[model samples]
Target: MDTQTQIIEQIAPYQPWLTLCGVLVLFLLLRATRRALRRRVDEIGYWLLGERGRLIWFWINAPGVMLHELSHAAVVLLFTPFGFRITSITLFRVQSTTARDRYGRVVRSGGRQSLQLGEVQYVRPQGKLISYVGDGLSGIAPLFGGTAMFAFLYWIATGYNLWDIPLDAHQNWQLLRPDWPWWTLIFAPYLILTVTSELWPSRQDWTGARWFMVGLCTCLLLALGLLWYTNHLARVLSLSTFMASRIDFALVVLVVLDLLFLIIAELTARGVRH
Candidate 1:
C-alpha cells in the first residue's frame, strides 16, 4: 500500500471520533473568535459613541440578527405539522421586556428585565416525541442557516462556491484574492462581518433543546456502539466520512470568516484607541 493508504488504514477505525473532536475544536475556536470580536466591537462603540454605541453595534450586526431570527422562524414553520406556530418575530428590540422560558414561565436574571436584540416566538408542541425533535432541530437552525448564507455570500463576493471548492488550505487562501467587482470589495466585508457575528446559537437558543440533544446524542452513541460490536460499522464508514467531510468544510468556513472579522475588529479597536 502507498503511504497515504497506509495512514488511512491505521486511522480508519478512529476517523469518526477524530472528526468529531476536530469539529468540536473548530467550534470552540469560532466561539472564542466571536467573543473577542464582540468585545472589540463593544469597546469601539463605547469609546466613540458612548451609550448610544449600543445602537451602532446593533445596526452593524443587524443583518446577522435578522438572519438568526429568520432561521428560527423557518425551522419553526417546518415543524408546523407538529404544532409549532410562529407567533411573533422581532428584528430589533428598542425596549426592555420581561423574559419568559420555553414553557412560558417567567425568567429572572438578577431580577432584571431582559434585553433582546432580535427574537422569534413559537408555540411548542404538546407531544413529547415531536417536541423533542422539533425543538432540537429548531434550536440548531441558525447553524445550518448561517452556513448556507455564508457559503452563498462567499460565492457572491469571490466567485468561488464553497461547496465546489476543495478543502486545500493553501489553494483556498489563494481563491480569497479573487478579482472583485468594485462594489463587492466595498460591501462584502460589512455583510460578512454582520452575518458571522451572529452565526453561533445563543444560550437561549440552546435552552429549549438541551435535554433533547442529550437524549439524541445518547441514542447515537448506543447505535454506534452496537454497530461496532457487530463489526458492521465499516459498512457505514463511507457515509459517515462523507457527512463528516461536509460538516468539517462548513465549520472551517465559519471559523475562517470568524477569524477574519475578529482580526479586523481587533485592529479597528486598536486604531480607535490610538
Candidate 2:
C-alpha cells in the first residue's frame, strides 16, 4: 500500500468509537440549538415560503454577488495604475467604474464580452498589449478568491493538519470522521460546492446551471455519506480487509463522479454562444 493508505489503515482502528461519540455530541448540540431557535426558525421558514419574501431575500443578498467582481478589480489594480471605482455598494446593488491603463493591452478576439458581476470583459486598449491581462484575471476572480478563502479557513481551523482525532474514541456507529471539528464537518460540503461552482464555467443562457451545480453538490455529499457509512459498517463488523479495499474504491468513484459533472457543466456552458 502507498504511504497515505498505510497511514489511514493504521488510523482506521481508532476511528469507529471516536466517530460515534462525535455524532452523539453533535446531535445533542444541534437539538439544543434548534430548541433555542425554534420560534425564529419557524417564522423565517414561513416567510421564505411566501413569494414576495423569497424575492426580498434575494435582493437583500445581491451585494454578495459583487464579491467576484471586486476580486477582479483587486487583481486589475495589481497590473495597472488606472484604479477601479465602485459607483455604488449596498446590500442590493453594486456599480463599478474603471479606466484603461498604459500598461494594459486589448484583444480583438470575438469571445463573449460583457460587464456582468462575475464575467470577463474585453476592452480596447489605447496602445498596449497588456490590457487583456486584467480582464483575464477578473474573469477568474471567483475561483481564486473562493479557493483562497477556503484554504485560509481550513488552515485556521486545522493548522495544516490533514485530520483531527476526536476526544471520544469508543463508539462505532457514526459516519463522519471523528478527527474533524464539528463546525468543519457541518460547513465542509457547502465549502466544497462553492469552490466547485467558482471553478466551473459560468452559463449565461441556461439558468439551470446553478440548479445543476446544486444537484451535483448534493450527489457528492450523499456519496461521501455512503462511503463513511460503509467504512463504519466494516469497522463495526471487524471486516478490516474489506473496509480497507472498499473505502479507497468508493473515494475513487466519488472523485470520478465529481469530475464527470464538472466536465458536463463546462461543455453545457460553452455550448451557449450569444
Candidate 3:
C-alpha cells in the first residue's frame, strides 16, 4: 500500500476519537466566545429595556434554570438510600463570586469582575459516597439532562429526529421545518438559550468529576490497546457506524447552528453599541 493509504488505514480505527476531540475543541472555543460577548450582550439588553430588562430576561430563562436544578434533584432522588427516604434537596442557588486566578490573584484582566453561578444541591445516600463516579454523575446530571432537553426542544422547534439527522451536512438542513404551533417561535428562543447555557458545566461541577473523567480516559485507552493487541481493531473501528454516527451528526447540527447565531448576535450587539 502507498504511504497515504497505509496512514489512512492506521487512522481509520481512531477517527471517531480524533473527530470527537476536534468537536470538543471547537465547542470550547465557541463557549469562550459566547462568554466574552456576554457582557456586551447584557449591556445592550439593559440599554434596550432599562433596569427591568435584565430582570425580565432572568425570569424568561427561569424555566431552563428550573429544569437544570430539577435534573440534579431527580438524580439524587433516584439513588435514594432506601429508594424514597431523601433528607435534603436544593433546587437552585444563584450567587456571584469574584474571579481569581490559579494562584489566588484577582483576575482583573478579563472584561468582567465576577461570575454569576447557579447550583443544585442534594444529599447523597449515606454509604454511597465512596465512589467519585457517583459524585461525577451527580455533578454532571444537567449535561446529560440538558442534552436530552435540547434534543426534545430541537425536535419541537424543527420537527426533525435528533438521532436521525442526515450525516451529509448539506442534506436535509433545507428541509427543516417546525411542526409546532406559531407561539413556539416566541418561547423557543428562551428554551434554547436555557438548554445551551446549562450544557456547559462549571468548575465546581467538575471537581469530583475530574477523577472520574480521568478514569474514563484511562479505560478508553486501555480498551483500545487491548483491542489492537487482540487483533480486534477492525471491530472496534466499526463502532463509528453504529449509534455514534447518528449522535455525532446531531451534535454537529446543534453546534454549527449555535455558532452561527452567537456570532450574529455578537456582531449585532457591537454594531448597536458603536
Best by TM-score: 1
Ranking of models by lDDT: 1, 3, 2
Better of 2 and 3 by lDDT: 3
C-alpha root-mean-square deviation, candidate 1: 4.3
Query: Which 10 consecutive positions of candidate 1 have the poorest summed lDDT?
Result: 166-175
Q: Model-by-model lDDT, in order? A: 0.78, 0.44, 0.64
- Structure candidate 1, residue pairs in collision: none
Please give, for residues 85-188, the per-residue lDDT of candidate 1 as tens digits: 99999976656767778888988789654567888888886767888888888887888888788878877777767656543555544445445565664677
Residue 146 lDDT, candidate 2, scale 0-100: 57
Give candidate 2's whole-model lDDT.
Answer: 0.44
For each of the candidates, the C-alpha root-mean-square deviation to the true structure, in angstroms, is 4.3, 17.5, 5.6
Clashes of 3: 0
Q: Candidate 3: global Cα-lDDT?
A: 0.64
Candidate 3 C-alpha lDDT tens digits along 21-82: 66566666656655654555576677677754444434545666677767766666666653
- The candidate 3 region of ten consecutive residues with least summed lDDT is 82-91
TM-score of each: 0.75, 0.34, 0.69
